[model samples]
Target: MQVAYDYEYQLAVADYWQGRPTMEPNVWVPSLPLQMTVAVPASNTDLVVSSGGQQELKLAVMEESTEYQHERSNPMEDFEKAARAFEDDLQKMQTKMHLFPPSMKGEELSKYSEPKVVSIGPYHHGKGEAIPQMESTKYAAACHFINESGRSVEEVYGAVFAVADEARRCYDADKLRLLSDNDFKPMMFYDGCFLLQYMLFMCRDNNDEDHPIADLPWVVVDKLMKLMPKPGLDMETFVGRVKQCLQTRRHLKFDPPILDESYKPPHLLGLLRFYIVGSTDSSTTDDGSGQGLSDNAKKVSLSVSVIELAEMGIRLTADKTTAEINKMRVTRGWFTGKLFLPPVSLDDANARFLVNMAAFELCITPDFGEVDDTMSTVCAYLCLLGMVTDNDTDVQELRKKHILQGGGLTNEDALELFTGLEKHLRPGNCYYNTIVAIENYRSDRRLWIKLYRFGYRNQTAIIAVLTTIAGIAGFLGTLKSFQ
Candidate 1:
C-alpha cells in the first residue's frame, strides 16, 4: 500500500491539538506514536513480516524519527530567537529617529519635493539615471571645492565617512535599508562639496577668474539665466532647475553657514536646512530636537492680503528699504502695516526651492494635519503667502505693489509658487490675532460714526446738498420755458 507521509502526519498533529481537552504532560506524545509503515506484496517478495515483528519495527522507527525532529529543531529555534531580537532592536531605533517619510502628495507636488540638479541623500539615490549634464559637472565642482582649499578629496571623504552612520539614521528605514556605507559616503561628500562651492560663488558679488566654478561654461549660463527671465515658459525644465540652485544660494546668505564642529547636521540636505532655518546662536539652537521633527517655536497670526489691508487704510510698504536685500522683517501699525519681505525674485526655480524646503518642513515637523507651532519660520512665511495668493489677481496685486518681483513667470504661473505648496502645510493657529483685529475694526460701530463726522464736520455735506437742490430748480425752470 502507498503511504502519504506528510498528509498523515499533519492530520495526526491537527487531531492532537484540536481534540485536547486538558494540558498534556508531553506535547511530543503524538510524535512518539507516529511512524511510516509499508508492506511488500506476499506473492512478489519473501520480505513479508509477521504481526509481532511488524509491531516491534514500528516502535523502533518512531523513536528514531522523533529524535531526528528534535535535532533539526534546535538550530531553527535559535534562529527564530535571533530574528525576534533583531526586529526589536530595529523597532527601537526607528522609534528613536521619529522620521516622517516624504509623501507624494501628487505628481505636481512630487516634482517640487524631489531634487532636480542634484540628489542629496538615500531617499532618492539610484531612482533614475543621473542627469548627464550635471553628473560630470558635480564631480568637477567637488574637485574644485576640495582643491581650492588645498585639501585632498580624501580629507573631505574621511570627514563624511566618519559621520555616515549618523547620516543614515536621518532617513526612513525603507529608503535606507539597501544603502550601505560604501554607496552613501561618496554621495554625501560629493553633494556637500557641490553645495558649499555653489554657496561661495553666490555670496560673492563678482565671480573672480580664480573662482573655482567661474570658468565653467555651465556656470556662466546659470548666472545669466538667473538675471534674465524667460517669457512663455510654463513648466520647469532647464530654466527652473538652474534658478532653484541660485535662489537657495541667495537665501542661504540670510542665515549664513555655521561651521562649528559642535553642529552635526544629519545629512547634506539637513545641513542646507540648518543654514536656512536652524539658528546659529547657541541660545536659540535646538538641542535634543529628536531625530525626526523640529520642535515648536511660536506662531504668529496670518496677515491680510495686500489689497484687503490697503482698503482698510493700512499702508503696505517694503520693510527692507535698505541696501541689504536678505533681511525679512514685518512691521505693523494699528492702521498701517509694512510687510518687509526681501525683494523676492519669483520664478520657477525660486518657487521650487521654497516648495521643497516647505516639503522638508512638512516631513520633519510633528503634526496631525496641522503644522506644529514651532515649525520652520521660513516655511510658515511661505505658507502664509501661498494661502493668501490663490490666483492671478492676487499675484498681480503683489507684483504691482513691488512686493513680488516676477523673474520670468507671468501672473498665472506665479500663483503656482505658493499655492501648490499650500496642499501639504499645517499652518498653526498663531497668526489669527492680526486677522481678528482687522475683523473687529471692520465691525466696530465707531468706524461708521467717524466716517459720518468726517463728511459733515466741515459743512462739506451742507454745500453738496444745497448745490443739488439749486441745480434741480434750474432744470425745472428751463423745462417750463421750453414748454
Candidate 2:
C-alpha cells in the first residue's frame, strides 16, 4: 500500500525520527498503512524498513534535504565569487590608460590633458575626425620601424598578436567589448611600431632626411619630442644620461636608483613616467610615504608663497641637477633657509606632458601594487609650484631664481597654469616632506623669524632711530670733552 504523505511531511517525519531518543525495536506508527512495517533500532533513531517501498522513500527524502541545504548556502558563495571578480577587474584597470578625470575637466586644462597632435593609446584612438588622418602616418612609421628592426613583418605582428589579449585588457572593458580581436590586434601592432619608430627618430643625434615622420608639422614634432626619451649616444650612455637626469642635487652625492631589469613597463607612457619620477622603492611604507615620518608631520599645511618665503629670508634656488619631482627639499642654515626645486620649462608641450602625467598619477589606484602616493610625484611637484606661486610677482620670483623657465608663457600664464592644476592635485610624500621640513625650520627658528620680520617691516624707522641716536651720542661726547 502506498502512503499518501507529501514530500514536506516525509521530510518532517524523517527529521523527527532522527532527533528522537533511543526507542524500542519495531515501533509502529498509526499513520502508516496496515501492510507497511517500521523497525526502529535501539542504537539509533533512523527508520529501518524491511519493505522496498519504505526504504526508497526514506532515501529520496535524505537526498532532497541535502540538496535544500546546499541551495540555502548558495547566495554567500555566489556573492564571494562576484567580489573576487570585481577586485580582479579593478586590478586590470590599473594597468590601462585612464581617461581624463572629471575633476580636471575644463577648457583651460583640455589642451594639456587631451591628446592634440596624435593619439598613442586606445583611450583617444579614433574619437576625432582629424585623428584618423594620422593612421597613414602610423602605418608609414610601422613599415619603417619593421625595416629597421631587421625582423619580418609577420614575426613582428605575430609577437604583438601574442600579447594582444593582455594589451586589450588595459582599456575600458565596455569599450573593448565593441572591438573584435581582428580589429584590436592590428591596432596594437601598428601603435606599438609607430611609437618605437617615433622615439627612435626623435632620440637620434643626426636627423635622417628620409625619416617617415620628418615631414610632420613642427608643432606636432615638438609635442612628440617632449615625450620622447632624452638623446643618448648608445645604450650605456643612455643609462648614464638617465641616471644623471634623475639625480636631484648637483653636489649632494645622492644617486637615484635605476629601474630594475625585471620591471616591465605596461606601455610607453609608463616607461616615460618611470624616467620622470624615478623608480619607487619597495621598502616604502604601506601608505606610500617614506618611513620615519609621523602622520601629524605628513598632515602639516604649507600656506607660504614664494614672495613670503623671500620676505622671511628664505631663498628659492634651482636644483639645476635634475628635473625629477622627488628631489625638492628645504635646507636651513644658521641665518637663512633655502628651498631647492627642480627647474621646469613651462611651454605648451611641456605643460601638456606634465598635466597628462599628473592625470595619469591621479588615475592610479592603491591596489595597483606600487606606492599609490609615490606615483603622484608630478602632482606633488605641481602642488608645490602652486603653493609657492600666488601671482605674477611670485612667478617672477621663481623665474628670477631660475627655478621656472617659462617658455613662451608670461608670468600671468604660468601663474594661471599652476593655480588651475594645484586645486585638483593631492600632495604626495615629497610635498608633505617639503612642507614638514619648512614647518620644522620655522619652529626651530621662531624667535629669529619674528625678529627679522620686525626689523624688515620697520627698516626705515630703525635707520632713523639709529641716525638720531648717533647724533645725540656725538653731541654728548663734545660736551664731555669741553668739560
- TM-score for model 1? 0.52
In candidate 1, list every pair of residues with a backbone clash.
296-374, 297-374, 300-430, 300-431, 301-430, 301-431, 301-432, 302-431, 319-340, 371-426
Q: Model 2: per-residue lDDT, tens digit, 1-483?
A: 343321221111232334445433322221122233336544423455665646422233334576666665568889999999988877765466566788788666766665656666556766566666777777677666555555544445556655666666666778667665545555565666666565565444423121121111122222223333345213332333333432222444434345566655555455556676754443222232333444334344556776567656778888775566666767667788777887876666567767877777777653223565467678878888898888888888887888877455788878888999988776666666666666666655668888877887889999999999999999999999999
Q: Give the winner by TM-score.
A: 2
After superposition, candidate 2 runs with Cα above 4 Å error: 1-75, 127-130, 206-259, 279-299, 367-373, 459-483
Task: Name model 1 segments beyond 4 Å from true.
Answer: 1-104, 126-130, 149-156, 206-311, 321-342, 367-374, 433-483
C-alpha root-mean-square deviation, each candidate? 20.3, 21.8
Writing each residue's lDDT as its tens digit, candidate 1 over 58-115 gives 2232345766666655788899999998776554441132223345365556655545
Candidate 2 clashing pairs, residues 3+ apart or interchain: none
Q: Candidate 2: minimum summed lDDT over ten consecutive residues — where?
A: 208-217
Give the Cα lDDT of each candidate.
Answer: 0.45, 0.60
lDDT winner: 2
